[model samples]
Target: MTTGRDILRVTLRRNAGAISAGTLLLGLYQAAETAFPIALGLIAEHTLRERELGSLALSIGALAVIITTVSLSWRFGMRILQQASVTEAHRWRVRVAACGLQPVAGDTDLKSGEILTIATEDADQGADIIEVVPLLISSMVAVLVAAVALGLADVRLGLLVIVGTVAILSILSVLSRRIGTSTREQQARVARAGAKVADLITGLRPLHGFGGNHAGFLSYRRVSTEARTQAVTVATANGVYAGIAQGLNAVLATVVTLSAGWLAFEGRITIGELVMAVGLAQFIMEPLKLFSEMPKYVMTARASADRMALVLSAPPVMAEGRGRPSPGDDLEVEGIVFGGLRELKFRVPAGEFVAVAAYQPGAAADLAAVLAVRVPPEAYAGVVRVGGRELSDLPVAAVRERLLVNPYDGEIFAGTLRSNLDPGGTGRPVAEAVEASMLTDVVALHPEGLDHGVRDRGANLSGGQRQRLSLARALAADADVLVLHDPTTAVDAVTEQLIARNVALLRRHRTTLVLTSSPALLDAADRVLVLDGGAITAEGTHRDLLATDETYRLAVSR
Candidate 1:
């Protein structure tokens, strides 16, 4: 359904005023250039032949005026066109990013790296259509003016130039179609190669130990090689197309020059007219070449627009809502029937710390999705409420404000340690959150303490360090309800116990849920619920459940 013409039409509609004014100025510039040789021909035929001083001076002044017009018009016209192109490109790039960042996941087949390519390179090329339109119009204006001037001197010359140009363009147009197909293929291949590199970089450390890096390299190399092959195919098509255009252009120029000479030898035109005809014939070559190159710009813009449209046209997966509940911290899930959950239900009063251990591994993620507001109401048979109101009725932003569902291995951005912990500086104190998450040693490891610079995505930090920092960042948010899924997966047993104890003490008055089977966190919880066979089958304090229920003991120990 995405024809890619949508982006092109929208871009043109928004910049209509700018394009009109810029094209007018550019047309004037091309007209001025066309007039230069005509003025010389007139001065040579009248002023110099008369041998009169006043006429020569006037002719020189006229030539100076024409030169000044050419210089000024070209300078200002290009400035306006270039500015519009840059601004339009920036606008599209930001629009693409905004679409990708929406809280409700969109139904898109594009991967992360492919989206990045579309937002940056594809946007930039598509905006070149703005510049291409004006330039193409100006080139046509130059050719039209030249033909008119030639016709005034000799009718055959004008007809021949126009007819020959049409013929050459018709031939080149067919070759350009082949170029368009190859260029589009080249763009897709490059995007796939980019996706491979992004995947490899994301898991670089883990991949390095298991020869995954080598396997990824082999995969990337194949994609890269395919991209290069497509690039070569595109290059071959363009070369053949340009070669034919130039060859035809040279033949047309040569024929016109010969015809003008024959007419002069037959005394059919004056000497000055012949000079003008020859000069105009030579000058027309540039405008004709401009005609030949326009197809390449059109093809590139169309291909980029197609890629951008893929991202922009993706469908949103959740309903748009603006409803919110009255303020409270109570969490409730009743008759929740989702994937693998058969009427699963649970509740936690305000200021309670609870741990959920699921025998079925996927059960934990199902619970996280419900609390995180990731599922659409129409897609499931359940009602999840916070503060006595349904989650589906509330705006996604409002839900996020009330409950922070920190995912496993949460993302880390490039910044100082303190900035990573409290990015907005609106959360709980950095020292307090860091201490509670057992990240005190990380601060001490760097002499600058919280000021220590962290690499992008914590690439320079160990997995355990990244995990603890993720925990610390979430702890600082001060949300009404907090859920941590497998927060201690990467840490040692001793460190996990300390983190559980400190987190429990720091969040004593806040509602918190730990969705993990880690023994340290489970034992530290005020109460533990065992989820098995798609429902909560047993519930008690961790020590009591361990002694009383064999299923709870086995599941937690796993």
Candidate 2:
């Protein structure tokens, strides 16, 4: 597990060369800027003392060199630093995205909106640390070099510059801490607001149909208002900090100028030295301001990095199995006790069509999850076997390739119908799956047929259409064992009947498990298991169970 500090260290190490070059160039630029006023003062003194044209030309030439160096170094240094910052952001974004995609144990309690914020906004903030270090080093180098040059010219003036800079930074550091706290609160509020909006948008159609749109709107508005208030508070703090920084800088510069003027008036320092003191005093303001803001950047970057580390360091939910699954179609659940399943035992032979009618909704979902490998084996006390081999001992990839559990509410990505149906480009003939899933009517409605555009999460399609499309995609996988949970609930009775018959015929020689309460699907299966009270109480053909078991009859009737 990596901490925030470890992440920062790794990032710095990765970009060490770029950081060093940028820091060196920036420091040289600051040095050259400081030299300008000193050169002017020296030229003035030389003119008054020697009155030599040759010496004047040489000083002017040196001033030009300093000006050129300042411009060139500043331009190149900023380019390098900015590019490095962008690259760092890109790296963090990719890492966070990949981590989010992996299956991890336990609940992360992170919504899609929060994950989006971390990958985008928080990633940029984490990358800002790249610039903060180099800028701090360069600013300190400038301040130190300026102070030394001033002291070399006149001891009193140099002492004033160093003492004033220290006082200003001390005050600003306290204020920056406050800013950091406020920024964290602001970011959290914004994330919550974004999450609320995303949820509302995803369920907009349902909310509107149920006449809950107005209530949902009020909820979103409340969260949005809170985020707005936090943002305002953050902005106010930043404004106050900026004002204080600028005002203090101006006051210090004024004091330094006045002191230099008094020394020149008293003939304690030459005219050139007095000019250099005033110039150095004014020039130090930018570096002082940069130094004051470094603490705030550092704090923000630490917070963002910590958020990123939360995702990156999450442990996997289950240890991966090293063994591959053996070739077989039989699936056996022995003495299974997890969630709503209590000492459940069942077996489906090779090339058999089995249906499980679970009365409890939670049991149905939990059973589906167990079959899909969504839950860790450690969470349950059971032995699930395929081809006489334990599922826990088989590699996840091999199990997934052989057995596919299509949940009732599967996801539909944004793309063409054809792409969604055949994402792997397996070239397994989309027409057969579409026909078996009874989606031919949907494909025929659009001129583009399989190429018809689908919105995000199949928003553009009807609920029934989306369900059929999801079934079609699962069928296209051509897995040896297919488990479907209520695959025809969204469609009408006629469509459901057609889909059930078509699926039975299409997968006649394959092992299939259907967990549903629908009569059409249950009647189509070769065997039906009545699951109740965490156990299978009865098992037989669908018609036999319906006639002999009252509980099973009532469950399928609804």
Candidate 3:
């Protein structure tokens, strides 16, 4: 199981090689940087000791030039590393997004909002490692360079600096493990809170109707507060680790200075050499500090990568068939058996209007899903034939291209009426679809008509209006076979009757399937299939079923 983190690491390694090279150059630059301060101390001491003014002045000038050159190289090298990190992070984000779209046919059990958060927040967090970790490694190399230079000035001071750095890093390594644990906990809490909030927002209308809106709000508030507290805990742990690393660096710097001064006083080392040794020891602390912080950041990224991997690995609901079916208008479900529609068989001629009126509401919805190939036959044994061939053997893309399923709960995005009606903009005009759906009344009421902007999920529209808009969208698609589930469920009896007549008239020469319990719709159907206990128990005209079938009459009478 090579995880998403593995993918991220491989991606970073491939792209951040340039950063590593630049960081190596920076390490060398730091060594040169350390040399300048030593050269200055020597020039000053020499100027005081034997009255060699010219030699000391030249040494000072040479040291100044070296300092300037090293600083420039260091700046450019860091810039290259920074650019490389950013590029690698962006690449990883796109790659992950592409991969996530795979296995799209299954009930991934992931919410849209959660996926959004993962793509934007978790993806970026995982990429942050590329930016910070490389620099931290380069800083460690800088510390090593300082240690080697210190040895040349005083072996004891060099040993002390190395030992102190090792101790601090070891402590940080232990602290990083704790931070990793806390970070994982915090991420989980945040995800849970996000999921709760998304559900509440989506179902806000239902909650209000039930007079439970306050309770739902309180529940979400509790989850949010818990998530916040966990985040603060993770932050506190990180802060403590950083504070310890910084404090250790400061302490080591002071200790090195005092030791170097004592050694100079005892004549064990020259004043200029002691000053240089102290400066190099203090330089050692900076890189050591960066090295200590890298582990925690890398750990946090790993945790987020693990979470994303779970979604990336989910099983898809349906799969693309191996063979492709020829494009045509004919559609059939042979021996199709599922949740409520079982052992059911039906067909829509190449160009004809066929309405499906089921006694069971669940059977109707389930049958529509099966016919649309939204649900897999593998879960519930069935065979759907499109264009006179088994749908299982037909490529899903080809099937979806000609077969459109207009779900009863279809969503409307926040956009102008024209955009919402033709989201795909598949060359279908808005005016024609609205007319076909009998939405002229709706447009007449709106001053903006086609240009009217809808709120999120068409919150501004009534239930019946939203249902009609969804129907308009399906009409706009102009697919060869259209499977509609309760298209007039939200409308009044008179409106339902009108829509039933209008729909049958508009789609007179097209292959159409409607799942309905309404008598008006059944009466308009060429044939009605009675589904009971997930099976097609009877088949006849609407009037015949009303005369003989008790279940059929009771189901549709309401």
Candidate 4:
């Protein structure tokens, strides 16, 4: 759904059956409860005024029946309502998770940690509307029943109860707006704090290397403090709202009770009627209290639903396409203008090994993001083609099957070493890939070899090992058009040379593009293109460029 109202609206529609059943049952319970005091007033009147034994016994029996109805209806009604609510919450959690994993990146301002909170706490709160609606209805049923009973005794008593309830609820609704604001702010601030904590943990290794751990912690502390302050504000607002609602409800009860006694004193009402009016007035306060509190619950639920809406309503990253790339794998780009690139163009013919050295920072990153489909098509100006067909015109699945882009910092999930390398469980022999990426050493050292356990993000592995593992995973995919972005940056000179030569051999007869300035990888490429000044300035073999171009030599030497 696109908005908080939509989420609530749809949830209600989806669980209408449960809500209806629960409301019916709870209404029966409330009717039974309202009758209890009225029944008592009747029993007291008959036993005192008439002194008829049969009448007293019959009144007592009716009271027993009312109590039993109250117990059974309440037990079954709440069970159904709560179960449906839990199930709805689970569905929302899954929906949020799926949105995050979708290929099209949505246009949303929420961070990963914020989404996490939405999927958990916000989802649960949003589903609370399921319970809130029914209970609110049930509370109204009780109030209406009490009003009717009190009116039978005295007209003023019933009118007083009705008007008092409306006034109390109206005042609460206005006051709850402040509570809503505070709740929204509190949730947002808490989500921000969570996001910062997640970032710090993800980059803890680098923070220690650069001695920025203290700085990171300090930044997180600021966010956490803000969250705490917002929480306190929400608590204070709720406190004030509840206190005022309770006071108003008590005042209404007192006024009704006094009015009933005054009527009896004037000899305008019978003794039985007086007892019933006083009992009904006191009992009405319970429903009134519950009804007044609903505004606060609804406000909190709406705020959560709105927080969830931010992610659900974002625009997709890519548009749908019906076309597909043609036969053969050829990498081509023409007149692309994006992020530090101006009219830049290049082509890697099918079955050719090509390397590009972009002298400017973020140039390779931009190219990789575009080629890998990490960027939305509308985000930049470019024509990137594969197999003589435009990437934008082709379907997302077709493009993915035709091309693969291996980034510098690939994610390494927690699993067995083999599972990390071949996440899809293709069962394709990854021995060649392992050897080519120089990851065989890590496997052999653990004795478990490919079955060795891998910590999340390869935390147990050294930097170079993680890099090789990433390369090995990419090589195992064996896509037709593979783009490697600085594939061997972390290894030593000798290991880098081996990986470079092995990648060239392993990827023979397939289109390969290496975006790197590393001399070892450049030397292994059949051809090298030098990117400078937003365009290709020179093209030749690595040695040919090194011997002839001073700028190329200086860049590669570093």
Better of 1 and 2 by lDDT: 2
Predicted candidate 3 versus true structure: per-residue lDDT over 1-558, tens digit per residue: 447667567757776677577767676676676676677667767876867868867887888788787888778877776677677667656755765654345665666556656766777777666666556767776777667766766788778878988888888889999998888888877877887876776567778888999999999899899989999999899889999999998888888889888888999888778767767666666666777778888888888787677666665456657876666678877777678766777677777666676656778788877776667658777687777767777676777777888999887788878888877766685777788677889888889988888877777777778889999888888777888888888778887787788777777778887787878888888778766676667888889988998877877787
lDDT of 1 at 35: 86
User: Which regions in candidate 4 have their CA more than 4 angstroms from the true location?
Assistant: 49-64, 102-107, 264-275, 412-472, 490-495
- Each candidate structure's TM-score, on Cα atoms with residue i matched to residue i, is 0.92, 0.91, 0.86, 0.88
Per-residue lDDT of model 1, residues 1-558, tens digit only: 445688988888788877887888888988888888777778777864797889889989988988898898888888888888899999999988887665445557677778888899999999988888988999899888988888888999888889988998899888877887888899999988888787777678888978788888888999999999999999888888888888898899888889888888999877788888888888888888987789888888999999888888765446666788668888888988888788888998889999998888788888887677666676678888888778877877877888899988688878988888888777567788899889999999989999999987788888889999999999988778899999999999899989999989988978898899998899888889888877888898898998998877777774
Shift in Å, residue 326, candidate 2:
2.1
TM-score of 3: 0.86
Across residues 1-558, which tens digit of lDDT does each residue of candidate 2 receive? Answer: 867788888889999988999999998988898888888889898988999999999999999999999999999998898899999999999999987866676677777788789899989998888888888988888888878978886788788888988998899889988888888888778988888987876677789889999999999999999999989998998899888998998888888889889989999888989888888888888888887778889888887887788788887656777787777889898988989999989999989999999988788898888888778888998888888888788777778888899999887878999999999788976899999999999899999999999987788888889899999998888889999999999899999999999999989989999999989999999999988988998999999987998878877885
lDDT of 2 at 124: 94
lDDT for each of the candidates?
Answer: 0.85, 0.88, 0.76, 0.89
Q: What is the lDDT of residue 127 in candidate 2?
A: 89
lDDT ranking from best candidate downward: 4, 2, 1, 3
Pull out the clashing pairs in model 2. Answer: 105-317
What ranges in model 1 sit over 4 Å off? 1-3, 103-106, 415-419, 422-428, 447-451
Q: Which stretches of candidate 3 lie over 4 Å from their true place?
A: 17-108, 368-377, 414-416, 424-426, 438-466, 493-498
* Best-matching candidate per lDDT: 4
